[model samples]
Target: LIQTVKLRLFLLLLHWFHPYLLTTSSNSFPSFPLARERMKSQYVTNICLLILCLGAANNTPWPLLIFLASLLPLLHHTCRVPGGSAWRGVPAAPGPAGWPLLGCIPFMGPLAHRRLAELAASHGASRLMALTVGATRVVISSHPDTAREILCGSAFADRPPKEAARLLMFERAIGFSPSGEYWRHLRRVATGNLFCPRRIAAQEGLRQRVAGDMVRRVGYEMERKGSVELRGVLERGSLESMVGSLFGESSLGREREEELVGMVKEGYDLIGTFNWEDYFPMGGLLDFHGVGRRCKTLAEKVRSLVGEVIAERRRGGLHSHVGLGEDFLTALLTLPKEESLCDSDIVAVLWEMIFRGTDVVAILLEWIMARMALHPGVQAKAQQELSACLGGAQRAVRDSDIPKLPYLQAVVKEVLRLHPPGPLLSWARLAVRDVHVGKSLVPAGTTAMVNMWAITHDGSVWADPWAFRPERFLE
Candidate 1:
């Protein structure tokens, strides 16, 4: 009885003060959103605890818990129009006055990159918008200059790792890893070993082989199934390209290659998933949809599989015929004392390289193919460039032939501009320190995202932005 009366008193007081606290004027409502979200979460937690305790003390039914849980969606993040005080202390950049707690998440559609671009155009000023997603405040940039200002700055060096990313050891890889000595070491390894001129030239044969194998597989499928499903074909070929580059050609047998491909798909799926926990400070405690668990499992599998391959290379067990230069595995084995990485760290680097490139190649190729199918004129021009470059001979396309075909290169560039695989650059950068992007100030701990899709299609930046004209590159 005492507890129930106390709860009733608290509720009465909350109801009385709720309207005054959520005022429309900047002077009344609190501007700092971190404090605001904390307070809101605290209220919900306290109310739930009080209700549960009240029900237990009085030996009432468990339906009270159910009722409270049901009301969570309706109770919080309501349509409270905050004033110009959305982004804490400073005057916020022009953007939407999102719901009370939910912010702009509900408005972002399935294709969030496209939606973010739309939001920037409609609600933003100077191609910049400040909005909240769950509890995390993000500053979205849709212009190339502003994006370059944000991305190229040393302040935006670190990344905001998602819950799954952290679970999957994001700190070890170059993709989401912290900016420090370790990241620099990885970069150095990439530059000196994997991407050197001689090594890239050696990989020309590997690319040619992968392309040929993909064509053969497509032909076989066309003869057998009477139609070509390019994604799967592209996926397998891309997987071979990535793994083969890292390890060696046909290093893994059919079974292991299949396993690796499946794992890559799973990893991509997990990374692409927008977990609500990723947005909030303590939201990981909720662990929606078992994403954390899945990521953990995937991380373990990646380490184990890649570790096995590393061990094989260390033992001189895996053979190679794909390149003139030593593969990434051999380079890792022979690294200088200063640049050496531990087994786990090495696996993480390899995982980033492998998983990052595989699906991207497939998606980009699919886009290029689709564009070619849509624009036969452009396709003919590209083919003419290729034929002229190859001297009208029926032979395999070599890497040396790439530089000679400017029209084909333009077609590829146009395809990339039209449809970027990782349109948001796969992940957002964390603003480590306060920085001014143009006239607006992006504070520390804010998530900064570059909408490349927006910049690539912006009318101000490009001539006839929506048209699929490969000749634009020729000019």
Candidate 2:
């Protein structure tokens, strides 16, 4: 029944996007609401029926009752605040009105972030705006001041505790974990133990070794094929770097690496894909889109893989290789049992770190390289700067030499400005309480997102914003 319902929604989406995809003629009126303005009536009617059906299946009749009880008032345009008119005094920041209940969901295509950036750009000097998505209201902050108010402050620290994220991530991973004692503890442990300066310095030799391997692989490919696939090389290098840091370098071979990478990528895609279940709470129990089912399967696989590694480490103290002695697992194991985290917690932390770090580095590097390849003048300038810094030395540039290569650093920064891997920085942040960002008052429970892409591209904020001019950073 859930699958059938999902198919209906899928068809609705298809009709919403491309009417031609269905067998129906373009001239025919839509079976559902054709005018987006009046979709609220149909949206509520269908959702009520859906809730009743879902409630019957689960033998819990209260869900349908509860939804209708709350929805009736909204249908009558009752004031959210008692004794006051709707949204009185507290103004909703400017944005598209969208459809009645569905809000802007139908209009947001695959390039949603870019679309948002376009919206932000049109607002001139205004850095904050509001968007209604389904039942949720989202606040988009496109300026540094507004972003800092939401990010640096504690009022908007928590993430939206979505069902898919909680179920798959167990709400234990640092990224998904709510803002509380546990999250703070995890952050402290991660920063102090995993990424401390001392620990980083200790891994210098290991990083150098990985760099050597990447250089050799690139050289071999160039010599044999007369060219090299940069992305593949970078991806492998990134994976190896993270894997080597987590477990011993020998723990993952090329075959295992390829297999695990595929699994990880699929897992990421499934988790990231928009699930209607997330927006509407009733869909959580219904499994309407099978997103929850897929997440459950993927979660099991991830747990099995992470658990095996932990079990192996417990059985054998550390790898025979001295280089593996400083791996994160080894460090985790060394902490006093009373003070240390549980095995489950450790696994979540390590997996989250590895999952996030690997792809990001590769993506950023690929973007930088691609930009360099496109702009010969900028590339030449960076090379000249590197040559001046290195003084014609044949040896590879070391970490210590980075500060000396200003032009190269500028190029990297420019690439980051032009093409951030996560265009929407800190993707989704939920307000725990009513918060004031600049002049706007973001009510409690509002989902806020920083449009870093918008900030980076704003013509007022940046001179010649669209151009890929690395030299702009130098001045």
Candidate 3:
């Protein structure tokens, strides 16, 4: 009898609010007798539910639980505070009215990029589309202008990392670190130390060795197995190349190199896997795939390994910096007191370089190889350009030689256009403040993402976007 009375009261409130008071202000709606009963019923319902839950734990009948479960949507709507910003005023950028807790997560399958684009187009929000994934508001930029605005806007300058990234210590690194004094200092130090022309020239020998080693490995794989699987070879070589650049070539022993390669692969996998915690509140507790657990283990390993390296350099244990090309480690070690990073920060910065760089370099190269096979004519032209640049001489390619091969450069550019390594710009950018992306106002605390894949593939953006045309870039 009591349960039936509660059910009738719940239905009555739902019926009242169905059209009459959903949009009305508190001045009129709260004064209603049903509204007063709602407030009182809320507390009574909580106590009743708790007692019923304890009974259910003792194998209570399923009927009551089923009935209560059926009323969840009503409960969720009733519990929401009135006059939410998402509903009031101009209204949040129009999108789907997702389910109670899951939001639009259940709708966006594996092809979330395509799905988001479709959703945007369907809602006539082709430029900036808004949606929620597990109650987290996310605005996606589907057009080039909108994407550019979000990318360049100061309000969206903060690159809030996904849950996996944070658990894996990405927040401390340059790539995902919040915009601030530390990030600026970190960027300056890294750029000055590692990316300068002088440093590039200095690392020529390291690049040559890594390339030659990769070619030899490919040949060996072919000879032994009659074919080569380049994924493992490329992944390992790319990681080692990044490590060599950071720690000075050959600073890490062979065993350590292999260990670090394994760890980078772990990071790459974790970063690629979608974690529920990134979207949903309290989602961290649901580690169904052990993503968080693995990320923690990886973080500890990276810190320990990178810390070991920094310690060795400090103790003068490595093959001396005697002939070294002054890697990032050396520059960081010699940083002025004002710019000096803590040991943990140093490890994060170094690990981040390798972790982010390897997979991207490897993947880009893989796409180039695929494109080369698909377009033999383009490959032939690229080869001819290379041959001309080398002037019939047997030698390795140099950074300076790049200017002499415009066609080859175009080939690389076109490949990037067609197959960008980071389809969503690697990760989503966060709105530090309410920002207007085109005409849409992305509220503060919302996540913003650029759909680079959509932009790159759009018919309006490129003439025959599906066609692989290197010559278009050359023009």
Pick the winner on lDDT between candidates 1 and 3: 1
In candidate 1, what are the lDDT values of residues 46-80, reduced to their tens digit?
Answer: 56567666766787655654476336434554433
TM-score of each: 0.82, 0.78, 0.81
lDDT of 1 at 121: 58
What 10-residue stretch in candidate 1 is worst by lDDT? Answer: 77-86
> How well does candidate 3 score on lDDT at residue 283?
81
Across residues 363-439, which tens digit of lDDT does each residue of candidate 3 receive?
88888899999999999999998998899898889878988999988988898988877777364799999877766
lDDT of 2 by residue, 189-241 (tens): 88876688776777776788888999999999999999999988887888888
Candidate lDDT scores, in order, read 0.75, 0.71, 0.75
Candidate 2 — which pairs collide? none
2 versus 3: better lDDT goes to: 3
Ranking by lDDT: 1, 3, 2
TM-score of 1: 0.82
Query: Where does candidate 3 have its weakest 10-residue lDDT segment?
Result: 79-88
